[model samples]
Target: MAKIMDRLLLLVYSIIGFAVSVVALLLVSRIIPEREAEDWVESLYGTDRLLQGIVITVSVIILLISLRFLYVALRRGNASSPSIDQRTEFGDIRISVETVENLALKAAAKQRGVKDLRARIRIVESGLDIMLRTVVDGETSLPLVTEEIQRAVKEHVEEITGIPVSSVSVFVANIVQTQTFKSRVE
Candidate 1:
């Protein structure tokens, strides 16, 4: 919602600036006499008169307004509709790897079979890759538990964050025993 408002504001500003510039240009052109073009130029440049001041002020204002419109349009274009080259930033803007890893860890921990989870993130040539190591209960079926954990984590991470997860490698490092000795004996 806020983003839409910002884009709308930029568009309005750009339109206003462009309209002002066009109006100023038209007004200036109308004020200049047709037959005395050369004399007007010579007098304006040669003598610092009122007409010269008006022309200078209008020209400066038009130039500034045009530049402002161009800048706003460029900025809004980059934000709302970005090109292929503008999609990826050169330095420190790669957030997919970290975001995917964090989401994966959180998802895996929430699964029924998963007792604990450890996730590792790696950035490859293709995209973001995630490796999750999950500990399950000893009573849980190994294959089924691992598969469920993988599916749950992958779905959650991909749905929440717009990052594509290349791979989810689930390693069952150990099985956790929640039953106490007394409970077992009883």
Candidate 2:
């Protein structure tokens, strides 16, 4: 809801900014006469005098607006990290999604026979659902490996975040054979 509101606000601002920019360009086009621009270039195109400083003042406002938007964009870009809010007795804590992902990956990796792991987190009504895609050794027991992965991921994520995990779904994507490089000397 808040994100939607923010996007709407940005839309409104962009519309207003586009309108203002158009007006500013139109004003600039009318302000400086091409024929006498060289003579009045030092005096704000001489329109500052004709308009009693309105030209210079408006131009300065536009410049400031452009700078302000640039600063806001930079700030927003830097704040793109995703966080989940947890309510505790003390207050609210924000946890980064990266931390949760790392925990899930680590849990899956701890299981023997797992060669590669991929984890994706989804929010459901219950809390979080962790979906894992795993690559394991060809000789591994599929049932045991998947069961272990599910249990491990669920336990670690719930214990760390204090958030109930609705489910841990494990998909065995591939069974890879171990390969060792051999060197031959002739």
Candidate 3:
């Protein structure tokens, strides 16, 4: 909900900024008359209490939005990537999701018949849920290969990271075809 609101605000802020910039450019370049700009401001200044209140409210909202943009831009790099955080006796241990994905890929690739491999890691309440998408050689048994991949990935990640694995899901995306090339004679 907060992310959605932030995105919506960003979109609104961008549109307003773009419109204001274009208007300023037009005024400076004499495409729009200086008198017209002054007249618009004067009209707003002479408006009723409701109109004045709305103008003030919009100004405050724009100011707040600009400040938010600055804050997000100047924040530290630690918040950039999601990590699995554990509170240890020593202190805290942080493992990046990318690191876990790489571990899963490493373990799965060591198994026979895997032609290509890709991994995704999701941090759940219980532990990590790993998803592996792979392409295997056509000659290999799918069930056996997938099971080995699941077990290997689960054990390897758990042993290395000390984080309990909720599940390992293996998806066989494709099978590599065995192609024979014909000898060419001159």
How do the predictions measure up, each by TM-score? 0.45, 0.56, 0.81
* Candidate 1 lDDT score at position 149: 77
| Model 3, global lDDT | 0.91
Candidate 1 C-alpha lDDT tens digits along 151-176: 88878876875556667788899998
Q: What lDDT would each prediction earn against the true structure?
A: 0.70, 0.80, 0.91
Pairwise TM-score winner, candidates 1 and 3? 3
lDDT of 3 at 145: 97
Off by over 4 Å in 1: 1-96, 180-186
Runs off by more than 4 Å, candidate 2: 1-78, 179-186
Best by lDDT: 3
Clash number for each model: 0, 0, 0
lDDT tens digits, residue span 1-186, model 3 = 866877988998999888879988998998988898788678788866676887788789899998887887897867657899999899998899999999999999999999899999999989999999999997889999999999999999999999999999999999999898999998
Model 1 residue-pair collision total: 0
Candidate 2 CA-lDDT value: 0.80
Clashing pairs in 1: none
Model 2 scores worst on lDDT over the 10 consecutive residues at 38-47
